[model samples]
Target: MDQVNIEHTPPAVVEYLALRQIAGLSPMSREGAEIGLPNSLFAVCLREEDMLVGMGRVIGDGGCFFQVVDIAVHPDEQGKGYGKLIMSEIMKYLKENVPARALVSLLADVPADRLYAPFGFEYTSPKSEGMWWRQGE
Candidate 1:
């Protein structure tokens, strides 16, 4: 596997979202607008041969807390640590860019939680449970 070519930019972000949609992690249309890139997201993207391979994003409040969202890698490119590479960069950014005491959270997808464990993330459960009330649910 080739080393991941990571970047934070419009094109890279669009690529990331497209790959995430393909991975079934993102809504198919995003309200009929793919303006995710160069719009408001800050992304850590991995690309090869103009192909979007992997990426992760930080979304939500600019301060206080942020959700680690949309981490995805193309199926053909999953075993090469590309997702880890994207995650590592996102974590690094949170550590360096966000305030020291700010909270960062992610909805881990099963085995993927193990990847975040090494980054000092732990279960909030057994202490405090997670709850959500989506707009329509």
Candidate 2:
């Protein structure tokens, strides 16, 4: 982990999309990335020697609601606690910035969802199911 740096900065557009693809997350269009990345409420970028290895972001209406999104760690870099590191940074930002009663949420994918539990995320199912829809569907 030499030269590992946790930057409170959004990754560049190309690296951002590449990391998502390499991490097996859904592919995002370039135009979408251009529009969305700048709107992040908070973002963390993990770099080793200045190369992007992992990242996470928070996005939502400023005060009332928030969601964690785009949590991706490169496959070659998995199992190194980078996910936890990213989440810790995000939690710190939320604690300091969001309103006390703001609704925070994330749509976790399993096994990886376990990573979020230690950070106090819990299942919202039964009470309400998570759902999604893409454009042109």
Candidate 3:
């Protein structure tokens, strides 16, 4: 495989939504992407030629709390270490920007959690659970 280009840049709304679909992730609305991407504390985009193939972002208050989100890679590009490359860039940002006691978290979808373990993520399990508020529930 040829070298993949990874950069500290966020994807546009169209590319962001498309990558989510390709990666089997939940869809984000156009307005959501428009508002959200700019607010990211750190973001990385992987490209092969002119195509956006992978992306990840860190979002949260600048201090005390941060969450790793939107980690996705194109289906055709899966198993190629792009996810780890994305995470490494995000982790680098966290290591430099977040304070020692600040909380960093992510909602790992099943097996993907394994990819994060080496970066020091652990299950919050019985001590504390991860939760989200749905639109109606």
- Among the numbered candidates, top TM-score falls to 2
Report every candidate's CA lDDT. 0.72, 0.92, 0.91
Clashing pairs in 3: none
Q: What is the lDDT of residue 136 in candidate 2?
A: 60
lDDT of 2 by residue, 2-47 (tens): 4569999789999999999999998999999999999999999999
Kindly give the stretch of ten consecutive residues in candidate 2 with the minimal lDDT sum: 1-10
Q: Write the per-residue lDDT of candidate 3 for residues 1-137, one digit (tens) a residue.
A: 45888889788889999999889998778887899999999999999998998999999998999999999989898898988999999998999999979999999998888999998999999999999975531
Q: What is the lDDT of residue 110 in candidate 1?
A: 83
Ranked candidates (TM-score, high to low): 2, 3, 1
Which candidate comes out best when scored by lDDT? 2
Winner on TM-score between 2 and 3 is: 2
Residue-level lDDT tens digits of model 1 in 1-137: 69657787534444555776787774534442355444444677678967777777787677888888778888888789887787788878787778878888888878778888888889998998877764441
How many pairs of residues collide in each model? Answer: 0, 0, 0
